[model samples]
Target: MSIWGKFAGAVVGAYFGGPLGAVAGTVAGHYAFDRELDKEVAFTIALIALSAKMAKADGIVSPVEVDAFYRICRVPEGEQRNVARVYKLAQEDIAGFEAYARQVAEIFADRPKVCEDVLDALFYIAYADGTLNHAEEVFLRRVAENFALSEADFSRIHARHNPNVFDPFAVLGIDPNASFDAARSAWLKASRENHPDQLQARGVPVEILHLANDRMAIINSAWEMIRKEQFNKDV
Candidate 1:
């Protein structure tokens, strides 16, 4: 079953206790099940919580941002209220985003790429309003730090979403002076890593696979652009 179906079911369980669990419990209400939360379930909850906190980074949650989230998360019609409840509760909760980010970092400690995916999702929401504001950038940078992502990692992800900048090399996390073979190798490695199947294996909810799909498109585009440029330069 999809993550939404899991949430819609009468019994909901979140193994980890803390801000994320609190928000999930509140959303699930009295329908408590005694079992460890599935990784995918936990992942969805984390995404909602983090997205909510990011929305408040700029002090307001624009409808466009919310719409972008819905599109990325693909919350079903029947489960929108429940999903929205989690988002709202997380936003209203007094816990700072760092706490939630820390929890997510710990939850996916072994899977750094999944953490990168989370940051990528946040960038998608941040840019939905047509710009990435100062507050939002600060919030994202701090979250990236909390996630244990390096500066280079953050820059590569940011390049994909930053409208005003389009450095294909940055998107592929490659040095401009790198050999064509090295660039092609980087493209292949990235494509393998960001594939939807790999993401699903890493506990990303299937609903969120579209994010992976979109990211793959960007990665591929960057490679194609680089390939064409190199060919023209050689000619």
Candidate 2:
């Protein structure tokens, strides 16, 4: 079934907690059973499904957020309404977002990189209005937990969107006071994981995969900062 067909059917299950459910009701007569959705399809749907909830979590959905969201989703102009319909449906769905998060997590369970990509997409939207508010941060952290993302992992990703301070250690997902060798190892691992080509190879869709460019840039900037700090300290 197409992504919308699946969502149209998915309104029945609280376990799905996704599109079609009412702000206080369930998706009307639909498939009682869950269809096996393609990972790619699921990926797209989840983006639409959870986005409204994320925006609402912050208490205000700005025009800028909406614009950033469309750009991140990269839905073709022709298909914009279809994606918007799902986003509206999801916003109206009252089921806990945990169900939606779980569904997405299940599809990418064995594919952690894909899960991270999902988080990256979510982060992009959260920052769309120019700041990550308290509600949005709480909402995203829970989503990350549902995706089995570690606190350190979530922190590193969050640091990219919210760089209030130039803390290289947080960007590298390492302890600030770590030994030089430990920091170097952390940077190498970050380099390997966030390399644009490597992320694309991991099955991240092209639209979302380009986010790796930003990730790589952040890692590179963090590493360079740390490198200079270390070199000057040694000299």
Candidate 3:
């Protein structure tokens, strides 16, 4: 079963049993899930390390970010012990950092929506100590773009701490549409124009590609939200 499935199973088992059973079930389920996929364990560790790297970008890593990461992992004491082992393994694999990001991109690629969750959590960590520096913003923006967030989405999230503003609709060169089809057409056109892959093919740098990816993610998310809003109104 997938890691996500195992987590779901544990949550389900916990509810059916006493609190103690739930705790035990959650641990056992995670252990089984980890054992079934060696690569998954490694990838999880790598992701944590990546998070760590991002956290330290500003030359300081806050206690809150550390705690948030542990909270996200959701492991019991025994499982956490194992996770510590994996964490150490990840720290030693610095050469694999880029590869780790690539792996993560693949794992979560099909679910671009989840990238927002990840980014939100990361920002929670970044701002936990009540401040964010330029280095922190640089790394966070890079990761956000890698997930293909669009300009609107990026600006929305970016504005959280950065404060300086930009017009999202204008960034995509679109105006309020009288029809859904027009809105979608404009959004799709912007997406194709800003696609990271397309820019990369034209010899854009990795940093630029990352920027494009971030913009695309935001555009796609905004379009989806608009579509859903229109559909709900019609319903």
Which candidate ranks first by lDDT, i.e. highest?
Answer: 1
lDDT tens digits, residue span 1-235, model 3: 4433433343333222222122323443532222222333323433455666665666665677777667655555645554454344444434433444454455556545445445654665676666677887787777766677876666555543332444344444456453777776777787775676654443332322344555676667666666676444331
Candidate order by TM-score, highest to lowest?
A: 1, 2, 3
- In model 1, the Cα lDDT at residue 97 comes to 96
Q: Report, for all candidates in order, the number of backbone clashes.
A: 0, 0, 10
- Any runs in candidate 3 off by more than 4 Å, and if so which? 1-47, 96-98, 158-235
What lDDT does the true structure give each of the candidates?
A: 0.86, 0.70, 0.51
Our tally of clashes for model 1 stands at: 0
Q: Once all C-alphas are superposed, what RMSD does model 1 give against the true structure?
A: 2.2
**Backbone clash total, candidate 3:** 10
What is the C-alpha lDDT profile of model 1 across 41-121, one tens digit per residue?
778888899999998887888889889999998887988888888899999999999999998898888787889989999
lDDT at 210, model 2: 67
Q: Which RMSD does model 2 reach against the true structure?
A: 4.6
Best by TM-score: 1
TM-score of candidate 3 on Cα atoms, chains taken together: 0.48
